[model samples]
Target: MKIGIIIPARNALPYLKEMLNSVQAQTRPAHAYIAEDRSTDDTHEWLRDHPDLYAGMRRNRRRLGWAGSLNAAAALALADGCDALFTASADDRLHPECIARCAAVLGADGGRDFVVPYAQQFGEAEHVQASLPDAGLDDLVRWPPLIDKALIRREVWEQVGGYSAKATPPGTFGTAEDWDWWIRVWKAGFTRYSVVETPLYFVRVHPGQLSDARAEHHAATVDLLAKLHPDLPWTAESRQWPPQHRTTRRQG
Candidate 1:
């Protein structure tokens, strides 16, 4: 299966070179795309000069937010006829075998819709938990299982109607889009697995990281999402997952 890699970029100038270099160093390098989200920094200028890193590069006329940029990249990857799309952040790095291993697992079992590789957190904000308010106590307790660097089949992505780009008041529209999408995927009968043997992703946590900067906004959005999808089990025992429990699958 052909895998397409998409990097949703904003003011990622600091991490862009390292991120692109890692992709190029992949054991089985896949087609790469950058959805530049009107970065205030030199992100767009650098991307324009480095044509080799990305097969297709497009800049948003205005900032599309994280979810919007990812949606754009996913669309481009799908249109390019990729069997699956792999998503990474400009601030993170993927191991050389990440894409290859995810593809192998997905290809081996047609029943598996997506593969989420283990990620090791690094940088200034490593392992830092978000501050949660007492009002959203339940949402705070159970952080959704995050597939930091995930490879998802096109069919699964399409089935969920892509990430929600709508900006809800109190929280940005795309806030918690990844968690929301995963919940929808499970609700739609698709299965996702985590690769625990090897931590194939490196997530950099810095001062400007979106999650850290807008923790409250994200929490509010997640609370709203849980309300909308009550069956998601956001507070269930499966919250501490991956090696914490067996891979989730629908009962026969």
Candidate 2:
């Protein structure tokens, strides 16, 4: 397989069909592997019914959460000689040309370890509805562009091990993996590029989505990251925004 797109999922079958269609509709197709994470939903039945389209698909023997399950899928892809690997959620949708555009950008001469693209929360206006801004995050710490599963070279992963198995559980991550991965990529001296034109992923925003509703968990994770990496630039203030229109100033 030239590329492997691994989706880590648990109790997400309602969105599974749309996500699968997004992958099948990609201008550039790759090996699609779904890491079940021991779902209670009818995911296995879904996979069995759609077996022909998938290059490879499997389930976790036990519930391993996002990081560990995705790592397992990545390892399987590497063993199959995939050129690159990427992980997306089961609840997200991809633009029709998302994979094609990503391949083109990552395969360019810049030797980028990963490529990024503009992304917006689902069902929201593009221009003003941008998710939690840079806040106190350095201007350089912008949102990650979407990644292409087909262009990442395996060596880059070897240097920077796959997503941490020890990290907090899925419902608790609150978008923490993205930051952790970016930090690891930055520390490894990998070239990260961003595509300014369009967004490849349309992220769902619901009350149940891990990201939309985990303030305390997210805050705790940030503190955890700070302790894990003391020298991180925006230590207590890493990539988070306070409530909109809220002010924390002293009055005379």
Top candidate on TM-score is: 1
Residues 143-206, model 2: lDDT tens digits? 3222322235577776789777544533552245555665666677775554435656776665
**In model 1, how large is the Cα lDDT of residue 202?**
79
The superposed Cα distance between candidate 2 and the true structure at residue 162, in angstroms, equals 1.3
CA lDDT of each prediction against the hidden true structure: 0.68, 0.61
Can you give the lDDT of residue 12 in candidate 1? 95
lDDT of 1 at 160: 85
TM-score list, all predictions:
0.80, 0.78
Best by lDDT: 1
- Tell me the lDDT of model 2 at 121: 60
Across 1-252, the per-residue lDDT of candidate 1 in tens digits comes to: 777888899999989899888888889868888899999999999999999887778999887888889888888888888888898888888888887887787777554677776666676544422211111223323554544357888898888877766424353535556656666666677754544346677778665553343545545655676677666556533233221322221110
| Alpha carbon deviation, residue 249, candidate 1 (Å) | 22
For model 2, what is the alpha-carbon lDDT of residue 249?
A: 11
